[model samples]
Target chain A: MIELIQHLINGFSMGSIYALIALGYTMVFGILQLINFAHGDVYMVGAFTGFYAIHFFKLAEHPSWLSLALTLVVAMIGSGCLGWCIERLAYRPLRKSPRINVLITAVGVSLFLEFAGQLFFGADPKFFPQVLSFEGDWSFNELKINPLQVLIFVVSIFLMLALDWMIYRTRLGRAMRATSFNLEYASLMGIPTDQVISLTFVLGSTLAGAAGVLVGLTYPKIDPLMGVLPGLKAFVAAVLGGIGNVRGAVLGALILGLSEEFLVGYGAPTFRDALAFGLLIMILLFKPTGLLGLKRAEKV
Target chain B: MTPSTKIKLNYQSSILWGIALTLVWISQSAWIGLMNPYYLSIIIYAGINIILAVSLNLVNGFTGQFSMGHAGFMSVGGYFSAYITTHYFAQSLDSLSQIQQALIFLGSLLAGGCAAALVGYCVGLPSLRLKGDYLAIVTLGFGEIIRVVVLNLDSVGGARGLPNIPGLCSFGWVYTWVLICTFVIWRIIRSSYGREFLAVREDEIAAEAMGVNTTQVKVKAFVIGAFFAGVAGGLFAHTLRYLNPQTFDFNRSVEIIIMVVLGGMGSITGSILAAIFLTTLRELLRPLQEWTQIDFRMVIYSLLLILMMLLRPQGLMGTREITSFFRNRRGDPR
Candidate 1:
């Protein structure tokens, strides 16, 4: 029973990271209906940015909450700018083209980021600096929890709540919602669809950047190719939660994270990677609309 | 214009095939001996890639199904055929005559293709019910699942990869399969069945409304495409004399998809040309990569893909054949 609880805590922390990334995927997909394949690489870039920020600010030496907050802010801003640029440069021109063309271009952009990242950052893995040492653990009887896990959970939940508030309470969020509902109608109704779409990318990328830093703090190993599997899995999570649905993405990610933790804890470790895809196929087969997705009839 | 003219065209086509076969025979028997091994190997690899790209085009280009799992099918064919040759024929290869050895290799290729086609049937039957990006994701998932499963199988060398397979593949073998794949797909594209594929691509609901059995047509395309991909994988395994699970990953699938897209999705000749061009380009970049100490080839390739989509989404041939240019100039109706 303790072990199960321990696994649940581990899964929750991991799932929170997935939720951060999935929110970005779900939001971009919501507004543009294009899978921003480069979003994963953007997360990678964010991690790298955080790494550089840590070094530049001497956060490893200082180790303060202020430095950590500064690193997160820098990473988020850097990734947000990249997301905006990706939208403007790679995707905007292809807006009038076929969805397949956009998809292919997105893939092209993804590959470009990965390979170029290798060229720029070098192919070797970099050890992320520990900005804050969450050395001790909180123990309750046989159950133990790492302070880092609690920090990750708190930060992610806070970000998600902020996002929810932004989307539901703000005028920009209203514009975003309107744009996603109908681009042409939204434009006609005086919403700046292009800006709204770009902002969605920015917002999503910012969260992914935060996730990247949190992951760096937790794992300490950062590499260019690290984003590929997590990106794909988070995309699956978004799909499972019902893509384009924000709450669904979070729910889906948490489910995926918990299941993966249980699978790794109790089942064969080699099949961990396959479990995400298997769950995807199963969910898609049984509930194409996803867990919280609405069923819409196809119009000819 | 007349029955006699149609007959004359058929005669000309047959003559062209005969000339091509004669050239292939000559190249296989003698010309290969004269060529440098470096260039010879590149040519062989190009031929194998041509087979992959053309077969993939049948489904992605003509049928308009965005399958991103071609590499999974290739890996299945490769591992299965490699298993047959290594376990069954490795011990007796020296005892067998030339004819017997060739026959065994041919049999393995067929077996590999059949295996892939069967797997394709299973994957396609259920997945084909979905459309567009949903279908793409499902296929990608299946492909990843196949790779993961294969990685865990100890008999196939698992993650270490299956090694020491016979190098039975040659230029002649690869080009022959390439020719067969292209010819078969071309015939399908020109037939009434081809129209159904195009109909499904143009609009699935409209095709279904017209009683076009869209699902069946899709499954057929998927199976046929998988068969050719399998054959290509067999050829790949034999040529390399080794099979690694990593060789048939998502990147490899993307490479083949790039060929089909750049070649002009539905254009067979374009696929052939693009395959050769991309393969040769990669080989050509080796020296540059050595000098620069950076892998710029993939970077260039990805950039090219992006630019191509932006500039000419229709691709090089844009669903038209190279021969169509000549036919159109002569005012011959296709």
Candidate 2:
């Protein structure tokens, strides 16, 4: 029972990272109906940014929670700027083009960013210098739980609540909802729709950046292509939960993370990829609109 | 008409085919002579890739079904062909006289093509139901699943890759398979079935309303496309006389997709031309050796795909044939 609990906790930590990334994918897809394939690369850049801030800037080592807080705000904002710039420059002009063209461009942007990172940082995996290391283990019956897992859980819950509040309560959130509901209608209503789109990207990417840094701290290794698989899995999660739906994204991420764990437990570790992709296929065939996403049928 | 006229037409037709074949043959042998068999081997593999890319383009470009599983069919063909050639005539091939060896080699090639064709039909049966991005993801998953399953199965020497399977191919065999696949694909493109596939690309509902059985048409193209991909795999396996699971990754499938996309997707000659160009370009670019200190292929591919999408959007040749130049100058078909 304890081992099961421990595994569940581990899965939850991984799932939260996926959930954070899925939110970015779902949110952009919600408003624009574009699958931003580069969203994963955005997550990657966040981790790299945070890594450099600590490693190159010589931030204090394992600082108290307060000092660590400053680093996150800076990292999140940096990531937000990057996402905002990408959307404006690479994506905005192609908005009127065919979906396939946009999709191909998204893939191109993803490669460009990843290769850029590789060129700048070199191809070798590097450690994300740790700060606020908590070395403690908790045992309940027989399950060994780490302090890091608890931190992951608490931080994710707080962020999720904050995001929920933002989406449901804030003025920008209302603008976002109205835009997604009907872009032209919202534009007529005098909403600064373009700004909202850019802000939506910033908000989503900020969360992703935080998630990337936290996950990097836990995993302790970072590489350029690291985001590709995780990004793909998260996209599946968004679809599974229903893209354009926030809570659905979270629920889908948890399910995917657990299923991945289960596959690791029983199947060849290599087969986890097949398992996740297989689920994407099965879910699409059964529920094309996704579990949480409300279907908006196109006019013939 | 006199018998001489009939003989002249046959002679002209055979001459055209012969000239084409000899050109490819002489060029390949020239490659073999200029560099060791190592470079020759690379060129042969590149031709095999052209076969895979051109076939895949029919399903992806003409039909508008995004399938990233080219490597799956290739592996299926690879393993099957290897099993037949090695399992059946290993000792006979090893101990036989020259003429017997030659006959067995011919049998193996036919066996490989047939096996690949059979699997194509089986796989294509399911493709009838899938469309768009949904089809792509499924195909991608199918490719990965095949790789894992092959790695696990020990009979075909799974993870280690089958090596020492008898290098039985020459320049003749390689070019011959390429010729057969190219001809078959080109014929399909000019047939009534080609119209149906194009219709599916234009609009599925319109095609359905127009009494075209969209599902059956799609399956036919998918099956034939998979068959050639398989044949390419067979040729590849024979050329290398080796097989490994790693050789057919999602990346390899993506690479072929790139070739088709880089070449005008619907233009058969364009895909063939692009395949040869990109394959050679990639090899040639690998020699930068820290001078420019860049992997130029990725940047070239990224820029080309992005630029084509942003500007041309429909690749260089689009659906127009290369011969359309002369044909257009002469007159319209009507």
Candidate 3:
């Protein structure tokens, strides 16, 4: 029972990070209907930004909540700018082209980011600086929890709640929702769909950046290629949660995280990656619209 | 000239050309034996890539099914055929006559292709119901799952990779398969059934409404494409003399897709040209990498892909054949 609870906690923390990434995927997909393949690399960029910020700010020498907050803010802003740039440069011109063309371009951008990242950052893995070290686990009987994990959970939840509030309560969020619903109609209503799309990318990438930093804090090893698997798994989470639906993305991410944790904890560890894809295939097969996705009839 | 007579004359000439090509291929051992081994290997690799790109174009280009899992099928063929040769014919390979060895290699290649086709059929059956990006994601998932499974299989050397496979594939075998794959796909594209594939690509609902059995046509395209991909994989394994799971990853699939797209999707000759160009370009990048001490090949390739999509989304050939140009010159506009 204690082991199960322990796994659950681990899953929740991991799932939160996935939620952050999935939110980006879901939001971008909602607005543009294009899978921002580079979004994963943006997350990597965010992690690297955080890494540089830590070093530049001497955060490790002066560990505090302020330093951590500063690092997160820098990463988020950097990634958000990157997301905006990618939208303007790579995707905007292809908006009138075929979806396949846009998709291929997105892939190109993704490859460019990954390889360029390797060129710029070097291929070797770097140990993320421990900015806030809580050198022990909180033990409750046989169950134990790391303070970093708690921090990850708390920060992710707080971000998600902020996202929810922004989407539901703000005028920009209303514009974003309207644009996603119908681009032409939204533009007709003077919504500045282009700006809305740009904002969507920015918002999504900011969350992914936050997730990247949180993941670095938890895992401590950051590399250029680190985002590939997690990015894919998070995309799967987005799909599972019913892509384009914010709440669905979060729900789907938590489910994926929980299932993956259980699989790794109990099942063969080698099959962990496969399990995500397998779950994706199964979900796609049984529920094409996803758990919370609405079914839309095809119009000729 | 009457259409029937034109087709007959074309068919007869094609047969003669096939015979001539066969004779040239038969005599290739004499000439290819003397060529620089380095250049020969690149040519062979280019041929294998042509097979991959052309086969992929059949599904992605003509049929408009975005399958990002061609590498998975190729890996299946590679591992399966490599296992057969290593386990079964390792001892008696040298003792066998030349013809007998060739026959065994051919058999194994066929077996590998059949295995991949079967896998493709299984994957395509349920997944084909989905459209566009959904289908792409499912296929990508299946591909990743296959790679993960292959990585876990200890019998196939696990993550260490299966090594020491016989180098039975040659330039002749590769070109022959390339020609065969290209010819077969071309025929399919030109045939009445091929029209169904185009119809589905143009609009699935319209094709279905026309009673075009869209699902069956898609499954067929997938199976055929997988078969050729398998053949290419077998050739790759034999020529490379190794089978690594990493070799057939998503990047490899993207490389093949790039060939199809850059050449113009649905254009067989374009695929062939793009495959050769890209393969040669990659080889050329080796020296540049040595000079710069940076792996700029993928960076350049990605930039090319992006620029191509941005500037020329229709690709080089844009669904038209090289023959169309010649025909137009002859005052017969296709």
- Which is the leading candidate under lDDT? 3
Instruction: List clashing residue pairs in candidate 2.
Output: A62-A132
Candidate 2 lDDT, B173-277, residue by residue in tens: 777777877777766666566788889888999999998989887777778888788777777887788899999986688778777777877888778888888
Error of 2 at B154 (Å): 3.2
Q: Comparing 2 and 3 by TM-score, which wins?
A: 3
Which one is best on TM-score? Answer: 3
- What is each candidate's DockQ, to 2 decimals? 0.72, 0.45, 0.76
Off by over 4 Å in 2: A297-300, B1-19, B22-39, B86-92, B97-130, B289-294
lDDT of 3 by residue, B16-48 (tens): 659967865876856888989899899999989
Q: Tell me each candidate's TM-score.
A: 0.97, 0.89, 0.97
Q: Which should have the higher lDDT, number 1 or number 2? A: 1
Each model's lDDT: 0.88, 0.78, 0.89
For model 3 chain B, give the 10-residue run with minimal summed lDDT: B1-10
Clash counts per candidate, in order, are 0, 1, 0
State the lDDT of candidate 2 residue by residue for A1-300, as single tens digits.
555676688788888889988889888888887778788888888888888888655665656676456557777888899999988987888888866667767777777777777778777898877777566677666677887767776787788889888888888788888888888999999999889889888988898888878877788899987888888889889889987888899999999988888667656776777777778877876786778767662100
Q: Tell how far residue B104 is off in model 3, in angstroms.
A: 1.2
